[model samples]
Target: MNRADETGLAARQGAASILTAVLKERRAFDDAFIAEAASGHLRNAEPRDRAFARAITATALRRLGTIDHILSLLIDKELPKRAGATENILRAGLAEILFLRVAAHAAVGMNVEAASRDENARHFKALVNAVLRRATREGDAILDNLDTERLDTPDWLWQSWSAAYGEETARAIVRMHYADPPLDISVKRAEERMTIAEALGATVLPSGTLRLEDAGRIEDLPGFDDGAWWVQDAAAALPAKLLGDVTGREVLDLCAAPGGKTAELAAAGAHVTALDRSRPRLDRLEQNLSRLGLEAKTVVADATAYAPGRTWDLILLDAPCSSTGTARRHPDVPHLKSPADRDKLAALQARLLAHAATLLAPGGTLVYCTCSLEPEEGVRQVEAFLAAHPAFRRQPVGVEDVAGLGEIVTGEGDLRTLPCHLAALGGLDGFYAARLTRAS
Candidate 1:
């Protein structure tokens, strides 16, 4: 095959690999898979090719529901129950032509040729061609005009969000998921912000984060080896900052893994104990601490069951939930997760909070947080916890306490962030963090 044909083939093959990984292998959608696939076609594939593959996969994932809806419109009776491979090719191609604005002729021809190579895909070429061509002209209106309710999210999820945050905010959340996420970084030290931003070709966020327009290999960046900073969304870095005046105080970082907040705790001169369940994940936390030259006591124990011997002055509960708020970064979550998943996760979060409450010293602070947009997992979860345990009271995060975080913190003392919050600055991650105190 010639150069043009080679690139086309690489794109198709990469998409197929990613589809298999998400659907079959159940791997996280990331750059590693694309890079691995590129090893075969182009010797030392350029970042451009890697980007093309990632875009195709991300586009297909974000718009899967809409693309499937459009496909149903084209078929006379129904598209055959063909192999997953064939369906993935059609989905990838249709997504590019319909949603991503790739040329109609190019998308259709390349996909058809790519499909013909596989025995199961050969028969679907005609159907695929028809769908892509039809989508090329009217696809935008078809997608744009569809009921946002039926776009990608489950009805129950939409209803839950509407009930909690109103219909407008909920719909805005859905819309933001389809928007691309910018790469965000948190500096280890304050003064390094300008140097790091200039070095990585990033701009300094109002929140003091380094926001990169285009995220490339981190190892090649200025601060990667020196450990001047680590990659973290601006919103994700807020909870630790809100835990005010931790210097010379004992803090418990519950559910700390990959230890970003734990680093913050140590950096603030807090005597920190980082607890997590996974040994491998804890190993990573140790590695990160070593890189930052920060020391913290590490424990590998379950959050719901583990108990520290004594009470802590501060506790950071980065509770696990459905992680729906991170959909822009982890697009597979919405599809892989169900309403049942949220309910189960909420139950577990409540359990963890119940346990963490016992470990807090009188008048100490506990910051309950989750990288989840779902109210059931955040506000509702905290509300339920407060109701169950009267000793714990809301210690409101005052505007003066947290710099650059006034908008996200609610009057009720909850930190609520959505993907739409900083759209112009390449939007922050959706998350919720609440600071509470145990009465003396």
Candidate 2:
């Protein structure tokens, strides 16, 4: 095969391998992609081809439910038991035909060619060709009256969202996933944010997050190396701001790795102590800080167990959870996580929140936040914390605090943003943050 054909085939195979890792091995998508690279499955591929592989993998995962539904209609019977990547190959090909704008012939011919080369699926190459070719001609008719929103979302998520936000709102959230979310960034130079946005051809989100639509390869963006801005979802950027006027305050950031929140706190003139358990993640955070020209005291210690010598004036805890709110950006979330996963993470969050409350300085502010849609991780978690610890009371956030996105601030005044909240601007991640303080 020529180099171009070989590159395209390698991309397709790499995508299928990643899909297999996620679906069959039950690995996280990012981890699987990393494994593919580290293991040399994609390390030798050209940059453009590697990107294509990632795109195909992400698209297949995101539209998995819909793709599976279509496959059930076209394939009358399953293939041989030993068919290794054949099913995923069909999935990747079909996703390209239906969602991506690849030419029908390329999708079909390339996928068929891939099947021909795989020892396990070579016998069923005809099946792959027939199914994908038929899908090209009849896929639209089958999708015409289908409830794609429901099909695309897993039952556990749909039911949980229905119970938490009600059925109508759950459907709306599902619909929001269909639109490609825009990249929202936080500019360190507040006075120059507008100028940066203008230079990058970005729209200033209501929350002051510069929204960049179709900005390819974030590292390639101008000023990225200069650390002028960082890619943070508009909703994800709200929590650090809740510790009002953090200038010169002693700030502790728990779970601060990959430190978007830590960067925010530092940029706002806080004397920051960033703590997390993972050394590698902390190294990355430190690297990010270096690039941004920000400074923070870093510690590799568990948030739940660490008891520092003294308390801080302000603390920001962006605890880890099921991460369902990031489904739009990481489509594997709905497939990889479950209610049990939420419960497990909720327990950890409780431990972290409880420990954090103890470490707050008297009359100090504590801001607890999570990028999770589940109530147990957000509303309920804070409610339970406040109930158990009467000393700390909620310091209700306001619309003005977040640049007038009132619809996101809850009735009780916590910042509760949904992926469907800012529909006109392609929506933001679902996030819940509560600002609290202990009385003097």
Candidate 3:
């Protein structure tokens, strides 16, 4: 179906249709679905209406588990199957009343009216109305008593972080996801940083990253077409910076694709060799570098297997992982991932770290990083690699090295940027990074 049709189906047809389309089609949250379904049709949705629809959809998805919990307590019979339109209408209405704090009268009136738009949804009207009213009246009790800490997060994720960082820290991390993340951009030329910041009315972060309140359509930004800047998070930029004084050195960006780190390396005057297993991803890297007028020796091969003719002074392994740390930017990741996925990715990271170590010249640096919050994929992976390769030692980052990053460093000196830490500035993605040196 066309985008317009899909949205119409979502809004008029009920919340279940939108959620169904997302799960079955494996698509991102269809704000359009919520809008069309919420509005009873898809034509001419203004920006404000679209925003409200998006908020409604996001609230429901984020609190899907809790909403279900509330339903189980109130429903006399099992809620209709998820694929049914009845269940979806209930979910959307519950999300608004319970979580969104949307005014009860307005929320109920709109939901009931929206449900009547489709005959299939008619059966759900009584259920939706009763549950929403009960939730609204007793909402304070539910909000006060239901574990806000566990409301939206998976059990494994909540338990893991709580065990590692304490309940307060875990709750703080969870709280950060309730809001939208700011637009963080990394400039290609240091000189353009100020100009871009001024145009967007943003502040220059201590780490030299740009933090815009909300710069829509990055490509439309003043310097974007000119290739003067690219979008990289403040935390993601640290791996390249940790290599320290890379001028006139040869570096390898292993598994570099959508190559932000590669661009940073090239900008730092390193003759970079970029390698990846996927040719299409490599092609994107080449295109990015070309846009910035930077050059790199591009190779399409598995980083674990490809053998370049010579060793290099530095190598960066932005290893794949569970991506738990990036929940704010990519909320869908937590839903798609399983604990098994985390374990599997950890095993792969161990292999990539060992393999990347071999390509670093004696006395050179190997910076390992991942957008994963799990210790198995971060600290544990590094510890395992160090045990196997005694010649390499953890050269922990110093507090003075990276502005605004010293606080997130673990006792062992690895970088760990959590969403909670960045709440003041709209937060940053979770990341783990460590620098290792090979014995000469």
Candidate 4:
């Protein structure tokens, strides 16, 4: 076989392995990819092969519901419990043919060979070849007619979003998840936004964030090692911006692992303290800070119990939640999360928010935010906090504060960004933020 053919085969094998990890093992996609790469499963593959494997795996997970529906039509009986690997092989194969536009012949052939190599799944090799061939012929028609919005999203999540945002918005959110999300970056210096955007061939959003079409590895980009910018989602950067003019002010960033907001505060000249419960994630945060040449006092402690022994002029509690908003980037979220997970996270968020309030000095601004679409974690959480802590009151976020994202602002002046909002700008993560002021 030619070199290109060998690479394609290796990539399909890697894709099936990743699919198995995500679906059967319930591992996160990033973790699965790292494990596979570490094991040398993809070591010899070209960069294009690696990219293809990643794309196929992500597409299969994102559209898993619909892919399963199509498989059910082809297979008469329910798949056996031991057929998990076989099922994932079919999913990876079909994802390529149906979505990635991979050539049907090559897609089917490689997957069949991959199945044959696995002892437990070898019995289904013929089935894999037959189903994928049929899928290449008729899968498009079935996919075109299916209720994709319902098919693409988990039933529990879809129901919750519909109840919270109404049917129309929920459907929009599901539809957006089908497309690959764009890359957004935050420049270290606001004054150089235009120059940086031009250099990177990126578009500068009204909110002063830069958007780039997902090209390749971020480390390969210019100025990456120069500490000129860092990667932060457009919606995520808003919480720090709400703490207007942090020049020389003391700011505490709770649950700040992976430190995007802490970096924002430091870049704005705030005396920043970054706190989180996970040491591994904090290590990553420190690495990013070092790369950007910014500094923050990093503390490894639970935000709920962390007391710095001093009141802060501002506090950003970007509390941990279900993280459903990041589904666009992390497709494993829907499969890994459930309604019960949301409840547990919401309870944790409340405790963190309350403790953060204790560290806020009189008249200090506190921005409570979550990358969650759930009201119980965002709007209701803030409402409950305000009712319980009469000493704190909502400060009302204005359109001017979020750079004309007024449509996302609620009647109570909280910012609620949905995955469907800014469709023309390639959408943003579903985020909820409420700014409050402590009574002097």
Query: Which candidate achieves the best TM-score against the true structure?
Result: 4
lDDT of 1 at 291: 81
Candidate 4 global TM-score: 0.98
Candidate 1 ranges with C-alpha deviation above 4 Å: 23-27, 31-47, 148-150
Q: Which residue window of length 10 is worst by lDDT in model 1?
A: 34-43
**lDDT by residue (tens digit), candidate 2, 1-440:** 89889888888888888998999899988889888876745877887888888888888887888999999999987756799889999999988899886899989988888888888878888999999999999998898968888898999898889998898899889888765689989999899898899889999987788999989889999889989999899988999999989888889999998999998889989999999999999999999999999999999999999977888879999999999998888878899898899999999999999999989988999999999999999999999999999999999998878988888889888998888898888898999999999989
User: 315 in model 2: Cα distance from truth in Å?
Assistant: 0.9
lDDT tens string, model 3, 81-159? 5325666667778878877777788777667666666577676777777877887888678768788658688889988
- Please write out the lDDT profile of model 4 over residues 1-440, one tens digit for every residue: 68777788778888888888887788999999877766745778888888888899999988899999999999988778776479888999989989888888899988898788777778889999999999998998998899978988998898889999999999999888888999899999989888889989998888988999974799988778898998888999888889999999888899998999988999999989899899999999999999999999999998998866888878999998889999999999999998899999999989999999999999899999999998888999999999999999999999999998888899999999999989999999989999999999
Query: Pairs clashing in candidate 4?
Result: none
For every model shown, what is its TM-score relative to the native structure?
0.92, 0.96, 0.88, 0.98
Alpha-carbon local distance difference test for all models: 0.80, 0.90, 0.78, 0.89
Model 2 steric clash pairs = none
- TM-score pick, better of 1 and 4: 4
The C-alpha local distance difference test score for the whole of candidate 2 amounts to 0.90
Cα lDDT of model 1 by residue, 50-69, tens digit: 66767887888887777777
Better of 1 and 2 by TM-score: 2
- lDDT, candidate 4, at 192: 87
